[model samples]
Structures are given as C-alpha cells and as structure tokens.
Target: MKIRRWQFAAIILTIIWLFVRGVPLDPQVIFGELLLGFILAIFVTWGFRRMYEGQTNLSHGARVLPYALVYVGTFLRELIVGNVDVAYRVLWPSMPIEPVTVYMPLRVERPTAITTIANSISLTPGTLSMDYDDEANALYVHTINGRDPASIVAPIRRWEDLAIVIFGEEADPSDPAPDIQIGGDIDGE
Candidate 1:
C-alpha cells in the first residue's frame, strides 16, 4: 500500500502520544501499538476520502479551492435559511404543506458528487432525499411544497455541477428526461 504523507504523520503522532502516556513498553504492547497505529493511519486516510469511491489524486490548487469555498458559502446560506423557514413553519401553523415525492434524476456521475447533492437536499428545509436507486440512477426526494419537480431539478443540477468542479468529474446535464412527476400528478404537488 502506498502510504500517504498524512497517514505517515498520523502514525507517528499516534506512536508519540502513546509513548507520552507512560504505557509500559513490553514486547506485546509495542507490537500491539504498532498494529493499532497502522490501522488508525489507514482509517484516517479512508475517512478523509469517504465521499469518493476510487482513489482521488487530483491537485488541490486553484481548480478545486475556489469552487470548494463557493460550495461551503452556498451550503451555509441554504442551511441557515432552511433552519429559519422550518422554525417559522413550526411556530406558525397556518403554513401550507403540500407533501410530495419527486423522482429527481441527477447528472452527477461521480459517487462523491451524487452523495453531496443528496446530502445538501436532505439538509435543506422542506426536502428529504429519501433514496437513490443505483439501478436507475435517480433520486427520490420528498418535499413539503413541491409544485414542479422539473424546476427543482435545474437548481439541484446546478449545485451538483458546482460540486463536480470542486470534487472532479460529473455527467453532462444536457440530457433530457421524458417528464418529472410528483405524487402521481402531472401538475406536481
């Protein structure tokens, strides 16, 4: 296995921490600690890239940094707005909720990009990413007031495209769908 720089650092740090803790350095303990440190280093590496499916060796320079910043900014804004909206709806019972499920087709091909879109939708108010059918490559999202699933697709695809810019690689968004439906209503819910 090719050891990443960070993984090596993690292993060293773990060993140092264990040594500083004054644990008795028996042969068994030393072997166990080495094994534990190795495992922890691997775990850290995996966790850092949990979103990605395959090995990601992209240069983290101008190409990815700006888009990542944008993604964070947009996500924070949406999260705050969604929190306020959900709170307001909870406080004011007059808010109308048209519960509906939309079969939202995604253009992002990379697993990480797709996951980010799904997570962002679920995080925002009034929407939940119910499931992703890998067989059909589509998402089932439930929304509080969904009037047009097609319209929502545009915004979601936009977000995914930006995510691709940050994470690298995505399917083209120009592909067309027959129709987007919500709650078995052609008009949407």
Candidate 2:
C-alpha cells in the first residue's frame, strides 16, 4: 500500500518532534525507543487524518516552510508582548482593568485553524477565549482592555490571515469583516 501525503507529512513531523524531544540518534540508542517513535508517529498521523478528514492537504512543498517559520515568529512575538503587558498590569499600583467581552466572527473555517486561533487568543495576555459559537461561527473573547475593539481584533485578524495560508484554507474574497460586538463590561454592574 502507498503512503498518503498526510502520512508522509506526519512521519516527518514525528521525526522532528522526536529530535526536539531529545531522542538521540546514536547507534547505542535502544531499538525499542526507535520502535516506539515509529508507532507514535503512525498513531499521530492516523489521528490527524481522521480529525482533519478532507482538509489534510498540507502538501504545499517548500512554500509552507516559510509560512510555518513566520507563524512561529509571530506567535513568539505576540507571546512576549502579552507577557510584558500582563506583567505591567500586575506591577502597576493602579490596575487599569476595563474588562469586556467581545464576539468576533470566525473567518477561518478549518477546525484545526479555528482551534489554533482560539488557543492563541487564550495564550495572549489580557485576552481570554471564553466560548466558541459554532453555529454563529464566532468566538467570545474577554479582554482586560476592550475600549477599542478594532485594536483588539487587528492582531487577531493578522493571525487569522497567516493561519489561512498556513492551513491551506481558501480565503473567501466575499467574506465580510468579522462582526465584532462589544458585550457588556465584565468588571461589575
């Protein structure tokens, strides 16, 4: 039987993950460890294929490598900025916490992409992904400073744009701007 594209991708990813996890390639390495890695790779690949269903076309050749690098760099930058922002709020005597929940409609349709975006939002400081309205295709995010919804959403939109390309999802030209609704303040009545 021939290996599918996703399977190949999975194998590559698995090998990379193993290397990153510090699995040595020395000849003295145990055979069992290698066997385990292969098994784990197969399992992960199978699960990915099942989860993505018809959306596992990550065979974009070398084009995807740069996008992947960009995504990681962008994510790291956001993470650092978020940490610093949260640290400032924590250290400041007068905590300026004007919390508000905003409903931002989803543009990326792929489940993995949507999940990644949600996780990224939650990972960022001052923002918490509370709920995902699948029916409405929206995400409810609670932010420490929501006075400017556009500003809050701008970065997320940037991430989404990158994710669209990274995940190989088609960008719908007709797609309207995300419907952002400023929910009531989360501080108090």
Q: Which candidate has the highest TM-score of all?
A: 2
lDDT of each: 0.69, 0.76
- For residues 1-189, could you state the per-residue lDDT of candidate 2 as single tens digits? 244755776668766766766866665564555567778877877877765344333456456778668777887888898798789989994978788888888789888899998998999888989998988888889888866778778778877877787777887524566667887532232
C-alpha positional error of residue 128 in candidate 2 after TM-score superposition, expressed in Å: 1.2
* Model 2: CA > 4 A from native: 1-6, 9-13, 23-36, 43-58, 172-176, 185-189
TM-scores, one per candidate: 0.64, 0.74
- 169 in model 1: Cα distance from truth in Å? 1.8
Error of 2 at 171 (Å): 2.2
lDDT of 1 by residue, 54-162 (tens): 4333355355778778777787777787688778889997987677888866656778787998998898887789999797668888887666555456556667767
Off by over 4 Å in 1: 1-55, 58-62, 148-154, 170-179, 185-189
Cα RMSD for candidates in order: 8.5, 4.5
Candidate no. 1 TM-score: 0.64
